[model samples]
Target chain A: MPDVLAEALEQVQREVDGAFDAFLPVPEDTRARLVEAMRYSVIGGGKRVRPLLVCATAQLFGVTRQAAVNAGCAVEAIHAYSLIHDDLPCMDDDEMRHGKPTLHKAYDEATAVLAGDCLHALAFDILTMSDTSNDPFVRAELVAALSRASGHEGMAGGQMMDIVSDEQEYDLQQVTRLQQLKTGALLAASVEMGAILGRVPPEGRTHLRAYARDIGLAFQIADDLLDVEGDEEKAGKALRKDEGQGKQTFVTLMGRDAARAQAEILVEQAGQHLASHGADATLLVELARFIVKRDH
Target chain B: MPDVLAEALEQVQREVDGAFDAFLPVPEDTRARLVEAMRYSVIGGGKRVRPLLVCATAQLFGVTRQAAVNAGCAVEAIHAYSLIHDDLPCMDDDEMRHGKPTLHKAYDEATAVLAGDCLHALAFDILTMSDTSNDPFVRAELVAALSRASGHEGMAGGQMMDIVSDEQEYDLQQVTRLQQLKTGALLAASVEMGAILGRVPPEGRTHLRAYARDIGLAFQIADDLLDVEGDEEKAGKALRKDEGQGKQTFVTLMGRDAARAQAEILVEQAGQHLASHGADATLLVELARFIVKRDH
Candidate 1:
């Protein structure tokens, strides 16, 4: 685990945080409070996993640092917005996230809603900005990919399914579909958008996408497993709430041993998709392994 | 009153409707219900005033009909999303819109939220699509214009101001700023987007923006006047809602006669901004007049 890839990840995390701070509205703006809420929701939180995926995937093709960071910021913004809304009283109703009070508690419900919304808009704004890429086509493609991943046909729709399922029951297939849209869509988009930033043609991106698909499911399975067995201090949030909430998850449905085994297999399969990319994909492959083995 | 301009309005309205239907997710999709709620919130409703502004403004620059329609649809989707979110119980708490139950009333709060979010995503989706323009720069500019108009510094920030205004009081300037962001920003962006579609340079767009600013205020005044004087049946929803909520508006602050006079002056000023464009601006001028003269 102590490898060049791990060191690269630590560096990528700092770069991603800097990009977020640069893109977010400053505290001096007249509408500073709203921007403040946006910063609260986006900055000083998360594993920066999506950004890592973006940078790692982009590295495979020698994409420009700015282009990779720009797309990384876009996807990370989407991830942050989803988390803000997901913590709303009407949604998951969690009071704490990443060891801090959720945005709504720190500000207010309306600000939380608006902040999430603004973050969502900011993602597109950053992607479409000139700094993201010189080519307009790349910008448009990034918007299309990110929007589809984060929108109703994707994350928002999956959220609806998640909320609905709380009052009903979902089989393994239904929950899988929900998770794919809920978490996997954005995760896959991070990789897809990175490929786009690097100008990877659709034909060439097939294996990368295959890699993303495998990692997406494995990431969720790992998340479910963490909720069951991980330490709260390391996770920075409540664990085992999935069971307490009566929500069905991979670990609950598949049994802990079976789910863990499945995640390991998926990680192996994810690596296989990078077989043709040689050593260039070392970071991405290592990322898949990290998802399964990380304490958080 | 019955002129070619009015006839063009009807045509533009139909085109916008068709574009919305075409962009919305198909009914046969597994996520059809979310799309249905989105469609229900967007289609067969309202005056399509924003789209008309888009098309008419684009026409002034000889922009392609398809290009104009694409941008028009993008603006309409934002307006619809704003309205859906504005009507949420935590916001305005309206039960009906355009003579039908609000998205939440018909579906549920979660669906309403997701539908609003989806519509917002769809706006960007439509804007970045190749059909909007072959030139990626134009598409990128469109995304930038639309996102800034719809984001924190624009619509969402205005909404936050509005919700907070319920707990506090705002002076004329503050309320004007609020309205400008909430309503005027999108209205201004409609005209700006049309200009972008037409490849009008920033310097050339100043007057068109002035026209939009004037019309944006006039449109709000007319709306307030309608709340005071118009019939609910024609308006397709409740009237006098502003007064019922004790919300301050142009009509309330300026008094009815002064507000009406201000609207007339503003509309005339709006028309004057387009005077340099000559007969090509006829439709836009007529639209400015129509905004104030219409009962609903």
Candidate 2:
């Protein structure tokens, strides 16, 4: 990873950890179990990439670091819930995440499902309650954007399509549409949320969204590449599971060389979008490159 | 049922149905499936008790019926999601609800789960999107209240307690605590949401909450009684399943006679709270009676 990108990741991880630490106050009854489940699911450990994107996007729009922290944490909450539910027996049926038994394996499936549900709700609650955003309109916009991105038309819809599309042939456009809704929606929302907080102009918002869309696609391509070549332990999952499941992937549609070429193009495009915003986005450009080149 | 309560129930059903029909747009892709699941889960079934309370509470505060419609719909959405998830294999494991095969049985479990999750998210999305309330603070309050009621400290937490308690003996206080959190939280939220929309004074909010809490407990008591005396076909579920499962219930904790007596007292208290709001709450008082006296 580039030094700047690595530093941003470290900073995001630290902030996310701190933010989550303050959540789920110990209820007088069942304090231990509830807290443990929350901690286990969140502290289970991952790349913290979503939170990093949220923070980086916010920073790109000249928002204070604190202004973006809760939004960053909220995205992490959504990400964690998706992982938990996805690992359930009726879903992906995975027993492990981040090299540890998933929440259901650690707790019971019922508790894991409830935990995920609670976490999903909590994400919105946290976002709505953020103290940093003084403008109610800004807060409302942030909530609306995130809710849409997380709801049926975005992430959930993409997952449904994925489930229905398994083992089916699809062209690059279809694949791009799926990846944009599934992965890019939230990433784009993160940037938009930051821009909203910074009160960025409409032109800046458009550029930020373009930047997010290109980087989001590049990130997915890199993920596909990693699954084909990355270490299983570091990836915290079975490598090539998508291939095993006969799922469509960027590399499957485009040859590895072509996929790599496309990713480079997207990174360059994202950087160009950032360039108009001046030096403030220098690190964001580096982060985009790092995201498309990382092994895990 | 009292004539007024019967009329209120019919009105609430029509209002809720209309609200849902207006709010859920048919997305082009998953329009059929989404509408099917939504209609199956929502229309032509189940008591409209929660929505009625929302409408009634708003009436008590002299808010226009149109202002409370979205809040009413939001509560029903949460209620539907709870029923769907509760019937999952890992949760209550029930196959029936409202006299029909549960969502999971009607659809597949994964679809049911996703539908429930989507509905849960959709409720808040509706609240955030609702233009009925011009005050942003009121909107935020409604969102926060609903989130708390649904999250770990409320409905889901109460569910966790229920799974843990099972057949274990608990004192009356503990049982009441469980019921309050599990069933009462959302019921209370329904009433509170109306107040939020109406922008009721703090004192009025307290009285409205008391009215809801009493009716909520009475509603649960009536449900327990239905399990004991209900016809299998009419209830649309297997009667006595609660008894068969050795679950802790109001009927189990207190004898049927005592439980019935408690229901009467709760109804009276709810009526008393409504009295302060005058004849405008006449229908609400009758609704409370209907809650305790209903067969199914």
Candidate 3:
């Protein structure tokens, strides 16, 4: 990885961790356990890729680092909460995430559920705060973009498709659409929210949107590749479940070589979209490259 | 109920149902089941008390019925989602709500969890839309208020306390604190969001906040009483579960008669807080009285 890109990722991870820590103070009451569960999941682990995306995109238009990080934290919160729910005994029933016991396993299933819910609400709370942006328009638009990406028409809808995948046979197009909603929506939203924080108008966001779309797809294709061939210790969670369950994915549908090739091509195209930004886009361009190349 | 209050409640219920119906359209693809689950839980049932509170308070500031109803719908979405999660087997583990099978029981646990999450995201989605409030400030504030009320510091946190109540011997103050977060926060947020739509600043909302607080406590007290003395058929779900679990409650802590008396007193006090609005507050006052008097 490029030094600048690696450094940016590291800084965002730390900032997001600090922000979550500050925002969620354990209350001196019985509610402490719930907050503790939330903190346990949110404050650590994971690669903070979403926050890196937000900060990288926001930097294009001179948005403040604090503002970008705050918005990034909001998106990360949504991502974290979704992971919590996705790992529940009633859902994926996974016991490990980021190499630790999933929230339900760490606490109880009920605490896991509530912690996920509280984190879900906290995403909007963070976006709506003045700390995210001094302008109400920016804050409102951030909330709109993030919420839309998180809702039934977006991530949750995709999740439903995933849950049903066990019983249904989906074609390549269907799987792509499902992945687009399930994993792509929030990834796209991370970039869009950063643009919103920078006060980028809708007309001015076309390239940024395209860039996000390309990387979103590439990110998932790479994920499929990882699940098929990556080391479980490095991946920090169970992999190959899709193969075990006979679920169709990019790897299963397109073959391993084609999936890798497609992800690389998408990442290249993602970088091309940022060409208009010149040198200022270095981190974003590198981030795209890293998305497909990362071991995890 | 007085003719006017009954008519207002009827209208709000119909409008809320209509709003949710319009907002959630079942898709024509693999994601259809998820949307169906969300629609099933949100479109019907419940008293629509939160919506009524929003409309009643918004009316005090001459806010349009449509705008108020939209904001009210946002709050109702949160309320509906909370019920869905609360009734999950891992949570409250109930099989019924609002006279119908709970989402998990009707569908599956994963679907129910996803539906609840989607609805939770949808609340913020509705609030950020221009249909809820055209002003960006209003939209942002609405998101902030609703998210805060729904999150750890409020409803979800209260739920955490309730989950632990089975093991902990909570006194009256502890129970009150728990209920305040669990139920009072959302109810109060309903009134607060309505006031926000009407452009009522925080300082101008003191009386309305007090009114909401009073009725919020009264509402829970009534719920506790109903749990002890009301029929299961009318309540539309299990009754005496708190007693069955030997959990502390307003009725258990205060005794049935004192709980009843306290609710009535809170109702009267809630009405008094609206006295400054004269006859214009009639609907809100009646709603408060109904909070304590309703069988369900």
Candidate 4:
């Protein structure tokens, strides 16, 4: 199962990197700089979770793997931009991301900021420019979906909630709702984009969304768990920064043991969603486990 | 003619502000803050040159005025974001904009930077979401045109070039090319978006592009001329900061007298484009005169 997930991840990464590298505008100096910032933030590091979800969900409907690649690239671009901005001085204020200096720390803050902005715009640009999509309506739908996921109702809004609610206690339901918007929206978008490409049935779309939502929550919980007990070096940054910042995490709200148990249950539920889809979702099931069970 | 232009400008302000106010998202405090940054940068009082151009061009082809309002807002959003980012510490490092502290100064640098990014994305959001344009293909074209205008080949790329070439002795041609991509690209996009909304003829689009390009250069040159002899209070900025920074402008590359002469010629050429369009271009002709002759 782990081998299948690994193979899917590798394929998604190769295709996404190649497609992005090919599509980036060329020969202009400033464009080169923009592209470099994009490349620095995206290539050769971090788990390709979003892109893998796109590929796996498409495969569940027997869609051609090629069909998910562009959508995968689009989601990754959004994810990359989020990470870059999240690490900025005003946002998360982290110096290192994925074991290296954040883009702002590596380059200047303005470049990091502009690079993130360009990448966000470029995600929409790539979706709109996709020749393979064929249907303008589908393309428009994809653009609208991704924009909603990135905008006020989704990631940005969620980040704001997180900032305002830092160090504050909240009930499980409130915490869950916040995580659903912040982390789950994009994860949900990844699966939906793949389903859109696969032309999945409405029922299947609903099931897959639930699956994504569960796994997304589990992923965040697992991250909080890791921060509590994981190695600082292996975790890529200081392991206890969240607690240091008084950020409310699953571990903070619930005990470490309860959070771990909850994450395991969520992962099981995610697997059950894929079970009905059979061998088509074998990689997806493995991904769910890996997402919650991985050390780093 | 000037009275007509003034009335149109007044109408545009009311409509644009109303549309923007209505479309703003709710319930998300951070997103609202981002929107506030956008509204601050956009609605806070500057010459609405780009939005005016978009509206005037749409009017020239008998498009409904409401159709122009959304595009006007979108163009202003892009323009506002550019100003916010340009005034950042890493960019121009300006402390003031529109007689107020720059966005970075008003907010923190990171929020200001993120605000600019969000505003740029929001521009496309507004464009695609506009109800006036029912055609997806037309919306796609508008997105593409604006992206090209704002992306590496457009304003942002032009800005990078300007930053790199600052204080260097560039000739008049180089300066013109830089300004065209930076200032002129958005100006051209405004006109093109108007043409698309109006569903204008190909020849009409060409003429509008030509007119916009000329006016764009003339606009920059007039700015250079103003910087040489303008009032600081009215301009809302130090009068000679461009010269003080050793930046290359039309006045710096060519003599001030020559720059003024060139602006007049470009304005005349721009008016000639309007002439070819006949009575339809009456408002645009007046706009050209106002742009060249305005103090701020």
Candidate 5:
């Protein structure tokens, strides 16, 4: 990781953690099991890559760091909730994530389900709260953008596509659509949310959105790459499930060398969208490259 | 049912259904099965009680019927999503609702999960859309109220407490708290959302909230009473779930006559809260009385 970018991300992660801790109900609450599961899933693990994107994109328009952090927390909470749901027995049924037992495995299935629901609700709670923005318009935009990215036409829809993968044959176009919905939507929304918070007009945000799209696609390609060749300990979960499930992926469909080439091209293209911002977009440029290169 | 409330709620139900049908992603979408499940759950059935709450309360302040309809759709979607999740194999594991197979029973588990998620997202989507409210502040307020009512410390928390019920012994207070979180929160929020839509000030809305709280508890007590005495055909879903699960309920703890009397008292108190509003609150009062008397 580049020193400046890594340092910035590390700081953002801490701030995001503080926000989660502050907002989440503790284990002593009436629904202690659900709260415990929620806290466990969100408190101290995973790279806050989505939150960093929000912060970096907001910085381009000189928005307040606090505003960016609050929005970032909302996105991360949604991401965390999705992961918990995805890891459920009826879904991916993964036993581990972030180097620990997944929420369902660590607790019970019912508790995991409710915790995921709680975390999902918490995301909107964060967006609409007073701390997110002084302007209710900003809060409304965040809620709208965030829900669009996570809803039926976005992450949830993509996940359904993924679930049908084993039973249905998917061509590259289909796979691309799946990846775009499942993963790219939230990532793109993260950047879009930052733009919204910074008071950027809708049309004014085309380039930033383009940058997010490229990197979002590139991020998935990188995950596919990691699934093929990464270390399990570093990755902190089961690897090569795509291959085992016989699912179509960037590497499998495009071949390893071509897939690697495509990701590099995307990463480079992602940076160009930030060109007009010059030095203000440096962290974003670095982050885009990092997405395709990070081992986990 | 009273003539005014019965007619009003019947019209509100149609409007709410239209909003849901208009907003939901169709079966032709990529994850068509999940969409199908969602449509099956939300399109045709249920009493639409929550939506009625929003509409009736909004009427108290003369808010637009369209605005109330939109908010009603939002709350009903959340309620639908909760029912879907609760009916999952790991949760209540129920086979039927609204006289039909549950989502998981009608479809598959994964599809049910994704459908539940899609419905949850749609609730927020409804709030943020311009058709719901022209004012962004009102939209933000709706999102916050809806989420707080449904989230960890609210509906989700109540669900968690419910899951622990079979495993642990609980007294009346604990049971009441569980019922409040699981069921009362959303019912209360339905009334609250209507007030927010009408731009009713927070301080001015306490009596309306009292009205809702009273009815929310009454609603649950009615359900318990129905479980013990209502006909299976009229109720649609299986009766006697509390006895089957060995779950303690108002009827189990308070006994049948006492529980019935409590529901009646609550319904009366609920009407009393609306005395200041006179005839404008007639529908809410009628609805409260209807809760204990409805067959389903």
Candidate 6:
């Protein structure tokens, strides 16, 4: 990773962790368990790639770092909640994540479900707070962008496609559509929300949107590659389940070398979209390159 | 039920159903099933009491019916999603809702989880749209109110308390606190959101807040009463499960007669709080009474 991008990632991880720590103070009552479960998954873990994306994009428009981080936390909350629900027995049934037992495995299934829900609500709650943006329009737009990316037509819809992937023989086109909704949408939203917080009008966001789109697809392609070739310890969770389940993936559909080459080329294209921003876009450009390079 | 309240309920029910039907158009692809499950739970069933609360409160401030109905649909979406998740096997584990198979039973657990999530996201999506309110502050406030009410410190916290109720010996105060978070918060938000949409300043909302608080408690007491004595067919789901699980409730702690009387007293007080609005508050006053009177 470039020094600038790595430093930004580390800074965001600490900031997000601190924010969640302050946001979720475990109550004295039994509700403590629910908040604890939420804290467990949200406070730490993951690469903090999404928050970095938000911060990097926000920096281009001179948005305040605090405001950008707050919006980034909202995106992170949605991501965490999706992971919690996705790991449930009825879903992927994963036993581990981020080198720890999944929420359901650590806590009970009921607590996991409720914690996931609380986090989901927390996403909007964080966005609407004045701390995120003093301007109500910014806050409202942030809420709209995140909700659209994560809702039925976005992340959840993509998840449903994934759940049924084994039952249906999805081709490359179908898989691309699924990944676009499942993973691509939220990644794109992270960049969009940052621009919204910066008061960037919809028309001015084309380059940023293009950058997000290319990276989102490359991120998934890299994920597919990781599933087949990455070490379990490095990934911090189960991998290769796609192949074991005989689910069609980018790597399964395209040859291994071709899939790897596609991710690199997409990363290259993603960086080009940020060329308009020049040096100010250095972190974002580096981040896109990191997407395909990261083992996890 | 009073004629005014009955008419309002019927109107809000139809409006909310129509809004959801419009909001969730089943897609042609695999996502069709996810949207289908959401539609099944949201498009019909339930009392529509929450939506009516929003409409009645908005009426006091001369908010447009279309705007009020749209906001009401947002609240109803949150309510519907909660019910879908609450009925999941890991949670309440019921088999029926609105006289039909629960989402999980009608669909599956994974679909139920995703559909509930989609509806949760849909609530914010609806609020952010211009149809709810052209003013971005109103839209942001609506998001803030609904999210805070439905989040960990509110609805989800209450749900956690309820799940752990069987293991703990909860007293009347504890039960009240639990119900306040679980059921009362959303009900309170319904009224609060209506006031928000009408641009009612926070200080000026004292009486409306009082009305909402009173009725919120009353609603839960009546729910406890129904759980103990209401018919399954009329209630449209399982009943008497609180007693079966040896859980402490209003009916259990206060004695059925005292609980019934307390609910009636709350309803009376709730109406009195709306006295400032006089004839304009007729539907709200009647709605309070209906809370305790309804069989379901």
Query: Candidate 5 at B70: error in angstroms?
Result: 0.8
> Reference contacts recovered by each candidate, as fractions?
0.67, 0.46, 0.98, 0.28, 0.83, 0.93
Candidate 4: C-alpha lDDT: 0.79
lDDT of 2 by residue, A1-296 (tens): 76777888888888778778787665767535655787788863877877777777788667778769888777788878888887888878887788888898899888888888888878877877757476766666666777788777777667666666664576788888888877888888877777877887667588888989999899989988888888988877767788898888899889789999999999999999877768778777887888887766
Docking tier of model 2: it is: medium
For model 5, residues B12-128, the per-residue Cα lDDT tens digits are 778877877788657564688877788899988989999999988888788888898999999999999999999999999999899999999988888888888888998998899
A1-296, model 3: which lDDT tens digit per residue?
88998898889989999999999999998999999999999887899999999998999889999999999999999999999999998899898899899999989999999999999999999988787899998889999999999999999999999999999999999999998999999999999988898888999999998998899999999999999889999988999899899999999999999999999999999999989999999998999999999999
Docking class of 3: high
Which digits, one per residue and each the tens of the lDDT, describe model 5 over residues A118-151? 8889999989888789899999999999998998
DockQ for all models: 0.65, 0.59, 0.95, 0.44, 0.86, 0.93
Best by DockQ: 3
The digit string of per-residue lDDT tens for model 2 on B1-296 reads 76778887898899888878776666665334644676688777778888888888787667778768777888888889888888899998888888889988888777777777777877877777746567767777777888889888788888877877763666778878888988999999988988887888667677788888998899888888899988888778767977887887899889999999999999999989877668888877888888887777
Better of 3 and 5 by TM-score: 3
Off by over 4 Å in 1: A1-6, A27-30, A167-169, A244-246, B1-6, B27-30, B239-241, B244-247
Model 1's TM-score against the true structure: 0.94
Residue lDDT tens for model 6, B198-272: 899999999998998899999999999999889999888999898889999999899999999999999999999
Error in Å for residue A197 of model 2: 2.3
TM-score of 3: 0.99
TM-score of 2: 0.95
lDDT of 1 by residue, B95-138 (tens): 87898888889998767877888888889988888888888889
Q: Which lDDT tens digits does candidate 1 get at residues A72-114? A: 8889888888888788777677788898988888988768878
Writing each residue's lDDT as its tens digit, candidate 4 over A90-150 gives 7778887789889988887767867776677677777777563766666666776787787
TM-score of each: 0.94, 0.95, 0.99, 0.92, 0.98, 0.99
Residue A220, candidate 5: alpha-carbon lDDT: 93
Model 4 TM: 0.92
